[model samples]
Target: MSPLLRSPLAGSGPDLCYPLLLNTSCRLSLGPRFSASLLYILTFSLALLTVLLNLLLIVSISHFRQLHTPTNMVLLSLAGSDLLIGLVVMPLGAQYYISSCWFLGPWLCSAFYMLSYVLTSASVASILLISLDRYLAVCQPLRYASEVTMGRVQLAVGLCWSCAVVYNGGLLGVNMRGPPRRTSCQGECVVVVDGSSDWLDFLVTFLAPISTVVALYLQVFAAALSQARKMRSSWAAAAVGAAAAARRSELKAARRLGVVVVVFLLCYFPSLGFMGEDVSVNSAASFWSTFLLHLNSCLNPLLYALFYPWFRWTIRLIVTLQILKPNSSRATVLH
Candidate 1:
């Protein structure tokens, strides 16, 4: 009966989700069969790409000692979460989007939702950590070396992940206790967040992080400009030439990181327009909004490859299988 259902086109009496169960099965929601197949193939392709790219990022950061630093550690965290998104969330989501049926039982369905939520939360935290790292590096360069050390950054990454797991677990706890929320029938699995969880998700995942990141980037760019001025002014000054060069390097790094943040904002900002009293996600707008958010994960590694020469070098090394050679981790990827 729904607009999404393809019972009329399929020429079957009705396309039940579980065709064997006449009394309990839900109707399949889909478009024309050819279009649906093409869409599924595209979605699966995206999932595969996302997985492969993020995996490369993870390996690049984890394997190369030169790539190990406070900033790269946060990137590692982001890549780790993105890898999970591509690995777990995207496949499950693709299946649901194409088939409009939940073959996995209620518990696994809830687990899927929770896992997706946690991984996304971790990505947000990692982005926030990145913002903070750049902020300190640019705005308070004097303290950056001491304050943003590897151990501290590692702990922060750990907290970012552990806290996401615990936080999202509590956020979805209420739904887990009760029966899974069905969209229309027995074969449907969806999370229908009530007023409170919706607001919490909006705030923690969207509002608070967005506000913090925007504020930090604003300051970072402002400071980077000041540093640029200092670099230009002190380039000829023998006493501060070293300082100017350092500041210039930091400025370049900040600009690269800024590109990452700006891309994330562009991808994520559309979702801000999505919140309202209507919680249904059965519309084109909802699907694209979510797809854009997931697309951010895929775009990130590409950005790194574009902005960071080290990333491209590592990719070449990784692709050529040179990483298997002894002490290849010590090979110069960064100039």
Candidate 2:
């Protein structure tokens, strides 16, 4: 949904805060054969897949006791945020995409759009916090135990949620009333990312958080290497020093985190780049690129399972149980 076209419906008269809707309607007038059905199918399928995988991810993590840690709790919160996004935002976005219009009434439309933005913001913030936490653990392991407390994590999550609420909700108050028009037609409201708001969103949503993540990961990697060197120096003093093993694990974790950083950077920055430009030549490019940005949330659990051994073990246990479903009862009876 480019801001250029205010509304899909043409000849729509403005109601109370209806100018935006009319503008959207006017912009939505179609030209050629865009397969709404196919788009709906893909959109629905992605939404369903994202929901199912994220649900399984959350359930698996919750059920596995070994997976419980302050770090995993942050991941759990991330999963919850992504789950909300998949459940609430994706399907509705798909509907709007297919219909090329917002028929879901004005209030509902505004609320849905706002919620999508809020959840997305929260998810991004949570990811940044996770990176920060991991950096602390690897770089400052001794201090990490004290600093990254469960209470602190809870506070971080709360702050992320509050920031998302204020930022996204604030948009609702800054209404984007459309041009004065006389014709009456179906209407809806969408966030207007014009000159200032667009840059503001890019700064808050992508730039600042990305910078935080990059800096944290950089420090974490340097710290991990430093720790590794320190551990190697003491290898001769103690037989079977677990410090070396711990350093190895920390290095591996840092590498996995590097993947996350790369994914976040690759997925998100381009869209911001496009949006920040003056000319809207690549609006479709921006849309698809931003869509892929959301897809990052769905991809992370799988990446964790693949790259982190502990996560892999948890995933293996969950999958084994799922595969042995029919024999689960038999195993229970034998026990």
The prediction achieving the highest lDDT against the true structure is 1
Local lDDT at 9 for model 2: 23
lDDT of 1 at 171: 77
lDDT of 1 by residue, 1-88 (tens): 0011112122223688887888888777676779778777877888899999999999999999999999999999999888888888
- In candidate 2, position 257 carries an lDDT of 64
Please give the CA lDDT of all the candidate structures.
0.78, 0.63
lDDT of each residue in 42-82, candidate 2, tens digit only: 66777777787677778766765555567777788788887
In candidate 2, position 280 carries an lDDT of 30
For residue 76, what is the lDDT in candidate 1?
92
- Name the 10 consecutive residues with the lowest summed lDDT in model 1: 1-10
TM-scores vs. true structure, each candidate:
0.92, 0.77
TM-score: model 2 vs. ground truth: 0.77
